[model samples]
Target: MRGHRPALRTPRVRTRGAAIAAFVALAPLIPSAAAAVGAQEITVKLPYDCALPPGPQRVAVRVAATFPDRVAAGEAIRPTGVTTTVELPAGAVSDLTALKATTVVPETGLALDVAQRGAKAQALWRGTGPARPVAVPAEGSLTLRTTGDAPAVTAVVNGDLTLTATDLGVDLALGTADGAPATPASLSLTCTLAKDADGHGLLATVPVGPSATPAPSGSPSPSDSAAPGSGRPTAPASPTAPGTPKGPTTPATPTERAKGRTGHAPKVGDARAGSSADRPPAPPCVKKNPTDKSLNAYITGYANVRKLSGASLIPVSCVQIEQGDPEIAFPPDGSIHLLQKSDAYLDYQGRKQTPPFKSTFLTFGFAPTTATMVLEQAGPMTVASDVLLVFPDNIAETYVRAPLVLRVLDVEVNGTRLDVGPSCRTQTPLSSPEPDPATYPGPHLVMLGKGQLINGTDATGYVLTSGGPLTGEVTIPAFTGCGAGGEDLDRLLTASISGPGNYVKQIQGQTCAVGVEVPTEGQCTEDRQPYVVPKPER
Candidate 1:
């Protein structure tokens, strides 16, 4: 956001040589005599009716003087200068443009010069030559025009203006430019606003209130009521009155003049008020997976194995698996569960572990017991789950056990299953002498037989490891999904699964294949049945 600071311009004053000198020499004597000439306060009305946009808008302002009155000294009163201070509501104004002042009082030899600071302007006047004295025109007016960016200019009555956000204060001082006060018997300052080319007169033609009644032509002037010791008259309790205490006193300092004065500005019906309570509560946040009925979803992988006994392990063929019935649930407490049914076959060399050989059930669940889930909003969801290789009771010889168990950890699931922990390594082949169970977790099945696989968590197996279930933790990448009833729900989904206890191949000593190895990498797609859960109520 850029700020617009008022540009400083040097004051332009035009004065004839002898007249300025004479006026300065008599400046001291003029104040006392001017005080007795009667105080003349005029109502300045500024009618504003402009159609503005909701935000900041620019409008042109025009201030003009009209109808000067005759003074008691048998000479017509001439206003050489007019100084006005306008304060806009806080935060309601931005910048001003095209600010200028000009005189309309015909050839009593008056010229105009303008100076302005933030919200304040002074129009100075001087005689054209030493021979001409400043004189006010009975019919002409002095006009000041400037463009300002304000919220809305409601109205300016007396010296107070109203805006939609706050009030604006305006102060007017008229007399000689050199600080000499010349009292006028009667005068009228007409302030008009030109909005969108339509002129709206702000000055009130009719008498305002009791305090603002018109003074008769021959009536004693308002300045006649001066206090005993002070040479200035008491200002009336009207909006047009200056904000300072009334009495003869020094001119206000620059700091004092810049301060905003408080006054009442009438409110208009253009602004509407609203409260936040009126808004309806928002729907819960949730996401759902897409459904694909085809059971062709498969994950495939290939890995190179090395036997620690100095033999190069077999180069495994690519393995493909079928996946089905995928469902993810997110509860209010921020826990998530992912369940899917999958099946794959194990083949090494000439022997094949056919269907019903090992039942495979992939269950990924995430429950954060200590730290918070990073996938709560829209990031990758990482959770802990175990990779379980279960061999069901089947036609294969009673049951075969290997010498070591395999554990997969640090599984990351984004859009795809990324790294699957460190590769399983082995020192002895399946044919080698079995290591003690205490020394090594007797080999857990790293591959599952085809027909033994079930669709979901119903697959049966035995515990083969000591620490816990094969399920560790796995992360699922963030995905877009539909909420309950097809509402748009976006969230990072994650889960942790307690590993299915390792599958015990045999109780006594049945023999399966020795030195068998499985690939460590694969990709698959699943015809997953998607399910959606409604967001829980607060």
Candidate 2:
């Protein structure tokens, strides 16, 4: 049903004798695997009857826009690269000439209907005049080519974004041959679709699918982030999948929706507040505008502190200053060594929640007490990847180090809140690699990741653009700087959470496209969004 549709939908046009003719006419427009590559281009031309100052004149309105055939639900529907052309009758020039004008400037507005999930809204697509004012031609009709950014839409449910072009309005300003404003007050004209008795003025339809979320561990989605891990360019946008589509859509998680950050596109280089997204070691300076092939990264990892027997979910985002060259390898062995040029970003040290735990310290005797903690990013996370050749052995390994410090908010002795003080924190930052017992105050947090094929992404490694699971072990250093009024609870804090051999795991979603590029959609509908972080590790 997602492919070619049954002919019954258009019985009136497809008679038995005309079957071959129809096939011939539609052969070039068939949707194929190739068409599913990126954003597709569409043009709609229609005739309109305008209410001109000199009376009604029939004209043509042609609209060109770029759109993806399919989009995940709750994702931004950016109808980019749009331009509109309106043909004007000679009478338009005559009216302007009557005002002693030699040239005319115009602005246009196109009103169309957008329907999704049984709801319809009229959208006014604006248009601006060409760079130069139109020179008044002494003869027949003059044409005005204009462009504008269509107001974007966000689809929350599965369905088709059906657009129907209907009414249009144009405002004109006249100028004399001397270049002075002849009619600065401006003259306006309106028009309506002449032959849209049915749905002939329908522009285009984009199907919206569901949110993309990976299954835990062994259970993976059909395609997590169909991104090519090797950083290959995504294919060109293809035609809409042909069929009597039954409201294209996928479901969104309720919990994600509750957070208010799920189901929308995050801005390029957008990092979560207080997560080192805007720290010193920033990733490669982002260009004013990134090219189509460029990509960014975001990840969430589960960390289990062995000393505390508690876990925390860490959210991180990154950008690539330089793409890892596939043709070249670091240490030219049979396997390719991909030196990825990307860096992890977390901004200000965001205070995050951690599980509550009970600890037994010698000083506290046999008393059972629980400490509630908040974990914060110490600094920017530095990340890179290890890639193997796609030919013989297929493996994309990821590596990154996170600097972090934990602070205890409150401690309850048998349900009694203990004044651990605001400054109760570890003396040194947590380290992810194997720690040296002799070195008591060193800080670090690192993760080792394994790549998963983002189906249809054509990529084979855990490049910045691709995503997968990363795991690691860490050592929580000893506690220091505790207590208020010199109550010094350093020993209590260290006994409760400071130690080593902690475990961590995380899944990074595929990078989303920014600039003039198509989105890198894997199986995740909303999985690629850095804004919608997953639930914490329980």
Candidate 3:
């Protein structure tokens, strides 16, 4: 409604024919004042005005046209067709309901009623042109009526006029020039009524020109500021505090980096895999607090990563940066296998909730000595098998191979060596992992503080595995691929040995000796035998 074009005057051609013929031809154009009043052509709009509600609603057609000067009641003026339309504001609710209109010209005045419900509301009319469909867009105007009891509604011809009737069954009393009899106009309209779309009576009423009253000298002019009483002392400006940033410092320009504002870049971070100083402090690896801004940002970051990754697996990675006192131990092979509660939950478009914490433990391995992790269960989707890591240099990267998962084997602040996929079943899928620039794009790693792994597209939430369960789900950034229920979370554990014993003894917190197998060519098939770590004596 804010951007709608001004109401322009278009010529309405006159024609004479039966009611059926007139309806057929006039259906394209609005009926003229001559056709309705039996006088010279007069201009008016049918259903002269309407009441539109704040939300979506629909209304019907009001035929309008012009006539010669003034005409008495019972005189019929015939011409053209009837036009239909609606009024509304921008970003406001639209009338999506179905709408239809019917009109009748009684001996004295014209009457029209429009019905719109659901999506069937027809807000505009079309003329029957053989070649092309006539485009008669909806017209809406604004009218400033006097507020309070017995509100006076006048069409502001000077500015665009929009009449809104607040209530139904409102009385419309019309008077012609001096001593002319008043027209008793009564209109009852039903549909959705917005405060702005409300109409007082007719739609095609001629606007009354501005009154010729003289201006009062005491009235304030538009350009003049309000006058204040003299002798009032102006208040002194407050003194600035020491060591504080200057007030109203110029806003940061696009060319300037945001100073004092710090956080991890979207997806990239230090390439350092595990080190107290190099890695960002773990997120306390705690459950997300709903109102926590950092938590929200973290969740959003995770969601963004998931969107880019296009994987349905849950995300699990060590928190690298910390706002206050950030520190993490680097286990042998640079992997720290710590438990993590998810930050939020995600689901397929309103379908089913995927399991949560669907992934647990990651074993960091190097290409020379480590590189093989065990897979206890393959999980649900093959695509869910992947892990993203931020290197010491602040570069975010990913590794994917189903059934051969990674685990946090150890943590050492210095000289830490992380191991991955030692007992991992290769032949699953293997390649010296390389970051897809398009997916893992980022600024220089040395400059970034923290980063996030792109988790899969499942509902994400955090729940304490060791401590009391703190539960909360992250909000999906976009509405797509999310609804009430869907893939909630993903969890997995890769053992370091063969048989269920390797998997069973570990999760129970028992001391179990497990064997590790070295993967060949970054791919481990069943042919590889693992070194067994004997189970501890009970």
Candidate 4:
């Protein structure tokens, strides 16, 4: 049997027949050249949403601007191309319906050209000359079908969009398709110097007209305020037409000048605080009804000062006092006192800390027991007082305690009992040595001086609306702080404190009978005058 098997053949496997394939020769690929030196691209996101009916829609026409990094003064910087893309929401398809679309080309340094895409060619250009509006054909109004899922449609503007780079930055408004003035957004192009990899900077310059003369060396150069050695490049002068008159420069206002005087406190009685006669008439005080009672008052503002020993600025936080308790009582004599039950908290680094931290019973106390209020007919009702900010422990722990004195002045209540403007003055008195054991029971007290302290002047603008809430801005000037050993600190801290926004106090109810007696009509009028009420007879 084995011998007979030798003649057995291997099994044959049948396979499906294959079809013949055709081939064509293709061209070789070509690589593009690298971009030019100093070229940069900036892409901005344009987000838009529109409500549309059940159909396709075009919501926005997208555009892009390409220009040089820097342009010479008085020279035009034209966009390389203005590509427009008609955009639609997601999940939308074009219906091939004829509609109309329009957009105004900006009048700037560049020109534009419109180029159609395919043979379907439903869109038609409908504009005559320069400065004319552009119109295109569409199936439906952009305002209608624009409500649903649609994709972006792209086309090229067939005209010039140009602007002269006369200033540092040029702003272009984005218009709507209907030729309506719609500024969905704006584009800003800034001309800035280009820096090389080696840290060298390059700037472009345009020649002044031939009539123009080089500015005198002693006189301030147009770029004087600019960084040294970073002046605009000089170029050959161009011919200037005759009859071009140079305009006179306008002078800066006092307010403008005051900005330069940062860190310096304004004089106590500056023009801002005009004399009573010169001030505008105060708003009429809506007389409170017989049952109306005095409302509780709270002080809300900001505290900004340097750290005990640092050049960097400290974080800005809010300063607030809870209201009620030793109700802000304005005695008949116009004396204000607050043995406040609510604690004053300083929001420091997001942590709520009481002043004179670590010391129990030691709190912010107004000395002299009361503050005098000066009611003004034409201006604010001024409340002035001395605040004692006790810093019981020195940073180095060498000194037992330090006290900083600040004078706070508030003015102007346009409505109800709101005071929106205030000025503060802070000064460091000579630091006193450790207190004698008998005089100072618990710990030794020392004074903190200039190079060894934290202090500054704050200009605050506060708004106290009716129903007991406050808000304001606190601007602190450059301030110095000292090191533990009384060494000069490095940097000065300056900051602006904004808000807790929700800073508020509950208004405690009271009958007209309690506390200060309601002022009579005559008394109210008298209080409006600048005179203070004499202390009541004992």
Candidate 5:
């Protein structure tokens, strides 16, 4: 009886009242006026402070993220794009920026944009390659920063490093703030905090047309030498120190010191003792500096001089001389073609071999003629003895013993001779068609051809520039003790430097393709004039 007392009379609800109740319940789901007040995503913080290193040192930056709000179940945190700005020091190049980053992140992707020197800045996405380049405004002392609050975002940026150009005396930084700003995320700003090395600005790297044919092997060369294979200019400081003297020294600026040399002669203190007395009298001429624009233009002229090829002792071709006092012609082809009316002495014959000379694998391929003694070698030969032969003033086949390694500079035939040392390699050209570009993508960048000799004895010739073309030839006469026919097995000098991007042709017979497998030559057969292709390790 007590429970039914309150609801004795039931009242009917009006339709208008029901409608109003529904409107009130759905109001929260609709956009509220205050909804815009709260932050929709995490905030990005930039480092406001910056520090510059004393001298030239390279600096790099990386930006990563940490989790706070969860975007999805499996994905917790990731990287947003990183933006770096560099400020050049006063009097230094303004607003120059470079970047170094990798696309390695979890659950999220990132992009990197750099602005330097008021030039067009580059944007590289983590997963993708370089994007369209953009231009940035000039800047003053400021901190460069990055933010990643895209629509599909979740976490906040953990931290970021400031990048400063070590090579330049500039500083870089990021901005740090406690609260967030609701501005557009486009980081299109520039800064000036570092200065490029004085006088040591980057030089231009242009590819010349083609290589000229090498001069004939064993022939007397005129006084003038030829240009390098890449047609890059040579550095004229004297062939080497003791051999000759340096040209007039103009005031050298600090920038010149930082540029360094391209395997040029060492500085005064670092010069080596004269290795061999038999070393030909130092060349009378000086090498032109490779960095000189005028000299480089002159050298590139040889690209169309002549084409070298074929198997003949005396190459029938010759390239015209461009400059120098006593104009001379050189063997346009790489091979030494000695065309004689009658047979002549082929091997060292009158010359005495040197010591450490236990046994040498003499590799020779001679086509005996009525007057020509043409013996061709795959590369240079390594003899174990130290025996020297002297041409007699009277009439004696005299001999002498000297240094172990012989730097065959000039080749003498009668009284005239040709330059055949390291310098000569550049002067000579390939008889074969410029190496197939398909085999080596950037043909001009191969610094070492098949028969380049480096550092006197080491067969490992180095690639001159990081990505420059091959310069000289590469040959290895001695591989430990594995003799011709693979006998007397010694240390193995594998072809690590010979690979794709370099030259390695495919021929049927035992051709000397960079990294090809071939049967060993018979005992007594050696690779004469062998060029050593240098690898990064050895």
Candidate 6:
């Protein structure tokens, strides 16, 4: 939940809903990485507060770089294979979703503080990556893992050259799935490292002392011993060290080049999620009761039409379930019913998850109409697992009745956009039609989901402890509210999209650990997910 925006607010007046987000929530840990020099491997995970338009959100960062455990004086203190992973919680991503800029490829700028004896300087750790745009995932935080080379330090005095982390800036280049500029422009987030009382900012320290092997005649003299980009040198460098171009014959391959104190310009680097191995163990997880009790959840329900070729994904609006609530039940002959079938407040307005149903839904099995379907949670749904304790088998079954409002956004009946306004959506919340009043239960539409305990747990059928797939079948009811000014679009869509045997498979992501303390470390992660979809019931 660190970067999750649990709520997706609807657009008031004909807002063009684009696929605003696409992001990969990758693992932060990179397996065993070694530097060519066989230096000590150092990794640090730090917390920072990043300033965005929606305010400041906590950002977690893991930095991995290789440096000599100890270095002799006059020797270069260069850190190799510098990789920094920047993470933003799903809540923070929700803010960007609201802004309508979803896909992002970021360029990062960082500076690590350097100090040795009395000399103080800084090392540039600019990170770049390829333009693989990362989307705002339906669930989980957005992660950017990148590696780059930085300016190294040269030990001058006979002391420790301390490397400390400092604040950083990240500019996100918003792009679409096709790698084009999104509706909105780019966004910039400023993250300042949280001050650590224990000097946790210190990354590594290299001891500067006598070297068993002395510097060669052309080694950097004590004159210019300043770290690259340090602005001031402790001493002047040897003529050959500074690329001063001594004589023509000696111009052969200079070992070191002149590094400007102004620092290197930020460039786009390969930022894809690379392969990993030898992943180190994460810190122990600790959970505490939290003040916030609502867990953020997303239901990416894939709805199938009996006539369509494949299942169409219908992602629902953000829903919340109380924390610590036992989402289990015991039932044999009955189920929990809502409003006794006569609720007056049943309407089809709670619609926010709006994306044009992709995979061509052909009108009359031939014509293609630009159609948009928005799935809405009409009422508070229940996710309860029936624990049948009397039988030899636990026979755990989880049932969910999501009161839904399915809205059709647009219809291209010979260019009828002029006849109906944006407010003219599929009128009624989904409702099953019954001819007789005696059998008419209520005016609400619902999708039914059932889960059976399989992996051997108290509540294995329905994913409550974490997220997994919950599959069911939905019989889409007829449509109504979409006609205006003689354009009978609702009747046309009802005839095409409604029917039984429609499979419903919803993928749920991990919760923000509502009952756990804020910033739940390992207990709340970005990638814990359900592996398979439950078999759709008849």
Best by lDDT: 2
Q: Rank the candidates by lDDT, best first.
A: 2, 6, 4, 1, 3, 5
Instruction: Assess candidate 4 and give its lDDT.
Output: 0.20
- The all-Cα superposition gives candidate 4 an RMSD in Å to the true structure of 31.7
lDDT of model 6 at residue 372?
Answer: 54
lDDT of candidate 6 over 1-538, digit per residue (tens): 1123321111110001111110001111223233323467777787888765356777888888887755544455567788888887887677566656657665565656565433343334656544355677766788887665554445433544566777666655555555556544444455678864134466765555533245677665433232322233233222333322222211111011101101011122232111111111111122223234444433344555665433454433234454333333435665431111111111112323333342223234323334555565555555544444433233434444455666665555322342433454434454433233353345433333333332222333343434445665656776665567666666666776776666556655433333433322222322311111111111
Q: Tell me the spans in candidate 6 whose CA falls farther than 4 Å from its real position.
A: 1-293, 323-359, 389-394, 412-420, 424-427, 431-461, 518-538
Expressed as tens digits, the lDDT of each residue in 1-538 for candidate 5 is 0112222111111110011111110011112222111111212222221222232323232233322221211122222343323322421112122111111011112222211111111111211111221222243322223332321111111111111121111111111132211111111111122243221111111111112234487643211211211222322212232332222122111122213322221123322122111111111111122111110000000011001111111110101111112112235553222111111111222232211000000011111011111112212221111111111111111111111111222232222332222321111112222244463221122122121222222212211111112232222122222224433322221221111221212100111111112211110011111111111100
**The 10-residue segment with the lowest total lDDT in model 5:** 293-302
- True-structure lDDT of candidate 5: 0.18
- Per-residue accuracy of model 3 over 1-538 as CA lDDT, tens digit each: 1112111100000000000011110011122243322323322322323333332334332333332222222222222333223322322112111111111111111222211010010111111111211121233321111111111121111111112112221111112233222222111122323333323332322112222234377743212211111112222112222332221211112112111111221122222111111111112122222221122111111111111111112211211111122234355787632222122222222212211221111111111111111122222211111112343222121121112222222222112343222231322211112234454232111001112222232111111110011111221211111112343111112222111111010100000001112211111112211101111100
Q: Write the per-residue lDDT of candidate 2 for residues 1-538, one digit (tens) a residue.
A: 0001222112111111111111110011112232323676777778898766545778888888887767764455667888889888787666666667667665666766655544454455656676577887776787988776664565544545566777776655566788776643245565788874334577777666643345577753432222211112222112222332322122222222212221113233333122111111111223334554444444444565444322443423333322333344756456555455354444222222222222211112212244555456676555565555464344566666667777777776533577877777877677866333353234677777665333223443233444446677778888877777878888866775667777777655444444322232221222222222222122
Please list the C-alpha lDDT of all candidates, in the order they appear: 0.20, 0.49, 0.19, 0.20, 0.18, 0.44
Candidate 5 deviant stretches above 4 angstroms: 1-247, 250-492, 495-538
What lDDT score goes with residue 273 in model 3? 16
Using lDDT as the yardstick, the better of models 1 and 3 is 1
| TM-score of each candidate structure, all chains considered together | 0.14, 0.39, 0.15, 0.16, 0.16, 0.37
RMSD for all candidates, in order, please. 38.6, 27.9, 30.5, 31.7, 33.5, 23.9
> Which 10 successive residues of model 2 have the least lDDT summed?
17-26
- Name the lDDT of candidate 6: 0.44
Q: Lowest summed lDDT over 10 consecutive residues: which window, candidate 6?
A: 254-263
| Winning candidate number (TM-score) | 2
| Candidate 2 C-alpha RMSD relative to the actual structure | 27.9
* Residue ranges of candidate 3 with Cα displaced over 4 Å: 1-248, 253-323, 332-538
Superior by lDDT: candidate 5 or candidate 6: 6
Task: Report the error of model 6 at residue 117, Å.
Answer: 37
380-487: candidate 1 lDDT, tens digit per residue:
111111222232322110112222212222222311232332331122222222233453343233332211222232222311100001111111222232123443
